[model samples]
Target: MTDTVLVTYGTTNGSTAEIAESVAEVLRKAGLTVESLPARSAPGAARYDAVVVGGGLYAGRWHKDARRFVRRNRVLLADRPVWFFSSGPLDASAAERDIPPVRGVQRAMKRLGVRDHVTFGGCLVDGAKGWVAGMILRSGKGGDFRDFDAIEAWAQGVADALTPAREKRH
Candidate 1:
C-alpha cells in the first residue's frame, strides 16, 4: 500500500482548518496521499506514516483537542516524523509587542521530536465569530490577517519534507 500522511489540526474559527487543508493539497499535488482531518475527527495518532498537526491559539494555548492528541500519541509520534504548527499572533500592527506563541510551541515540538513547526498569522472579523471571539477581535484589530502566500509556502515545505531526498531531485 502507498504510504499515507495525515494532516490534522484544530480550529477556533476555521482558519487553522483551512491551513491544514492547504497542506494536504500540496502533499497530494506532490503525489503523496494525504488525509486532512480535524483533530476531533481524525484517526488515532500513529496510524499514518507521517503526521502534521496544527491548531489555533486560544487564550495563549493550543486547542485542547490538539494538545490531548499529541499527549496521547507521544510515543508513536516520537517514533515517526511529525510536524506541528500554530495559527496565531495575528499582528495588529507594528506594535513591536510580545513574542509569538511559536516559541513555546517549539519547546513542545522539541520534546515530541517533531520534525518541524511553524506559527502563522490568522484573521478575525468583528461579530463574524461567536461572542467570545467577537469580543476579543472587535475592540482590537479586526481583519483577515491570513497570508495565502505564506500558507502556500508552508504547504510546499511540508510536501518537500515528505518526499525522499533522492526523489526530490529531478
Candidate 2:
C-alpha cells in the first residue's frame, strides 16, 4: 500500500522543472515511490496515489500546460491527495505577493479540495533559453532567489502527510 507520488511541473525556462525534481528526490529519500515528469507528458493520474503539481509563474498566470493538465485530470485528482506549488517571483521576500497562484488556480484547488499550495522563489540565469526569460534577464531583474532548504522542508512535510497511510496498511 505504498503511495506512488507524481511530481509534475510546467515551466517556461526550466526553473519549475528543477523544483519538481528536487521535490521528487526528497520524497524518494523519505521512502516514497515518486515519479518526476513534465505536465505535458504526465501519465494518467490514476496511476498515482498522490500528486504534486507545480508550474512557473508568468505575468501572474501559471504555465498553460499545467492548468490544462489539471483540467484534464480533474476527476482523478479530485479523488486523490493533491498539492500544488508555484515557482517564480525573483524577489525572495515577495514570494507571496508576486506569485499568488492566480484565480484560475485557486478555483481549481477549491474544486479538487487540494491539500496545500506553496510558492517558492525562482531562478533567472543570464542566458535562459526562453524569449521572455531572456528579456527579463536582460532587463537586470534576473537573479537566483530559490531557497533549496525551504523546498526540501516542504517536500518532507508532504512525505510526512503521506506516510501515515503506508504505515496503516502495514
For all predicted structures, in order, the TM-scores are: 0.85, 0.93
Candidate 2 has what TM-score?
0.93
Q: Can you write out model 1's per-residue Cα lDDT over 1-170, one digit (the tens) per residue?
A: 35688899988678888888988888898888889988887877666888899988877788877887787777878887789878766673312333344455666688878877767776676545678677767677566766667777877887787788426453
Clashing pairs in 1: none
- For model 1, the stretches where C-alpha displacement exceeds 4 angstroms are 92-104, 126-129, 165-170
Worst ten in a row by lDDT for model 1: 92-101
lDDT of each: 0.76, 0.89
Whole-model alpha-carbon lDDT for candidate 1: 0.76
